[model samples]
Target: MATRDTHNLRSVLAVRGFRRLLGVRLSSQLADGLFQAALAGSVLFNPDRQTSAMAIAAGSALLVTPYSLIGPFVGVFLDRWSRRQLVVFTNLLRAALVLPAAALINGGGKGVAFVVVAFAIIGLNRFLLAGLSAAVPHVVEDRRLVTANSLSGTLGSICFSAGLGIAVLLINVLVSAGDSGYAVMALVAPIGYVASALLAWRSFRVDELGPDHVTAPKRAPMHSAIGDVVRGMGDGLAHLASKRGAAYTMAAKAGFRALFGVLTLAMLLLYRNYFVTDDDVHDSITGLAFVVVAGTLGVMVAALVTPPVTRRIGGWRWVAGLIAGIAIALPLTVSSFTQPLLVVAVFCVNIAAQGTKIVVDTSIQHECDDDYRGRVFAVNDTTYNLSYVLGLFAAALTLPADGHSPTAVFIVAAGFALIAGWYAVVAGRWARRVGDDIAQPDPVPTPVG
Candidate 1:
């Protein structure tokens, strides 16, 4: 009964600024989905591209490493600048970048030029996302944050998947499976970003989505800006360290992401190489697409289930149990690598990962001071991306080319179990110290009129 009442997306969407914010989130993520799909189709699944586990791992690292490197510094600006302006500028920048990115892909450019341009686009995306997250709390009632997050995050993901599906369809229809099709998909991304930017600029007032304090830093010279970012990041880290719940939540989410990375690489290699015959590349791509769809369904289910489940179990225990559940289920399901078992495993893992993400997001919002929320979220992004890269690296070193390594799977499972146990213990002690404050409602921010 409680779950049914809490499941209403309409209630959250009814909030004034929240609807516009959701539009911005959905639009940006839709572009991200399309951009990523174009890259995947052109690079990973392209017939001309020779893919191996090592190559895939290298590509994954290149894509994510920039986020880890730039996230902290970007968080500084998210705190210091007007978030509304940042969103508008970043989206416009991404729109401009996509044009050249599409040209390069269309013109058969694939090595250094491709990586550098794509990296810049993705890095800018990270900044935009951090700003959006920090801005969300400003738009809604505090008591509804979990529901708002679940709706926004899950719906954003659905839009992303929808974007990917559309890209796939365009690829199939426009140019018949080659660089041209992928290029067409890339062209679609910029429109979403541009639209999102326009929405943000029109919907939000200057400094309305805030730094929590009225004072802005004096406009620094270009050289001083860099120094300020460095100092601000240091201060952000120190501030995060002071918050026990937020720190622990970040660590727990990072561990789950690392596990996710390992399984993602493993499954990529497995479907692309092992499950299908050498001449059946199309069939392999189809199989992987099915897995992606199943994973999307899992994400949707997690969105529906997480809010009420977290309320019943407490956020920390809920995350811990979800992780522990995955730790136990992974090895048992994936050891044989049957098609049905693999699908089930993918579904379950995605559910756990998405649920954990929602709880952590809300916990961070609740616990972290608004002044430092951007940095804390930035650090959270950095940790998850770095851990994922580490997982990919580990998989590259350990998994066979065919990706048929039960031992490697078991190792990841064991890691998850260990992290889950440690997080549970730590969260328990912290909860006692704070007197189970996770259950307490955050002080509601004044609703944006």
Candidate 2:
């Protein structure tokens, strides 16, 4: 099975159009990481900037919540435009917007101007991502679509992480230069976006990443587009209601993402206000970077182990076991938190998070009809980000400035325990009842919208 998966992956990588599209994804995501890191540094880790848990939550809300709300519907318009052109336009817009965002950072402008530009850039980033996902089917063959998505998505994540690491390094190296230095770092990200735009423009025809000619239509009016989203979401939920295994596992995934967000907020506070003493923002950023590294390593481990492990124990069992492991391990590592323990805790949490995600995605693919799969994912993506934001706000209300609340940590563990218990009891039974009947379905072609 591993060998076959490998062959499929290689076959997808061999396609010229797919390779070009993958290049666009990598470079665009790399810029995303760079921009995100810069924003985090300017807002959270700046020595001169004072912040609290609530402030952090508000910042997160401002940056992420809109994406959660508006992202699902953006696909309505994606179907109307040529995806390749949309990609090119969005990358160019991001590049243009970064200048003001950088300037605002340079001048220390956290006022409305800065906020608007920042919001626009991030919103456009979301739009770009939706377009990219929609374009995948046009570049890859039908048979290898799953492998194509897996390879491209995995490599895109690595590129984003690389960009993040680079930005953090720049922040630390320019610690003395402060906001000015961070502004310079922000300037670096546009080069990536511009390069991505150029790749898209030069490598692919305007209609190459496309809504096929037969299905393509004029842009829907705003009201009509919104109505479509509402109807699609309802239909998606109905489909999930009938697919018990997928629905249960998806609920588990949302719960995990929310808890992960809570832990993330706690970690950020701990690093910024508790672990690093006196205004040493450099070491604070470094500590957080270490957590990222540990989590990334754990994600890598989960990716390597999950397929074979799930094949043996089954998806639900593997997912239930991973969450159960996290439930048992989190409080043990996080309650008496030290820097090393922080890394260990993040490592364990991501293993569960990514492992569950793999199973959940697979379950959705297997259980959902192809027509409904895209909308199910739209619902899934909406809940995923919203849950994370919800967790942030929930934690903000309860967590102290120093983020050293054993109570909060334990509560998170309890939350995980509950999710694991539900998965075990509900999803586990469903998996057992189905037995060996569960099988992979044909890849659902990526919807243009």
Q: Pick the candidate with the highest lDDT.
A: 1
CA lDDT of every candidate: 0.83, 0.78
Candidate 1: residue 336 Cα off by (Å): 1.8
Tens digits of lDDT, candidate 1, 1-449: 46444544567878879999999989999999999888877777777667777787788789789778888888887787889888999999999998989898887747798988888888888778778888888997666777888888888888988887777677656664567778888988999999999999999887888877635668779998788788989999999888888789789888888878888888988887889768555677678767878889989999988877666667888888989999999988999999889998988998888888888888888888888999888998899889988888888888888788988889889998998999999987897888764453435689997
lDDT of 2 by residue, 237-330 (tens): 7888989998888898999889988998988889988887689887887787788788777777776666556655677888889998999998
TM-scores of all predicted structures: 0.94, 0.86
Clashing pairs in 1: none
Q: Which ten residues in a row have the lowest lDDT in candidate 2?
A: 434-443
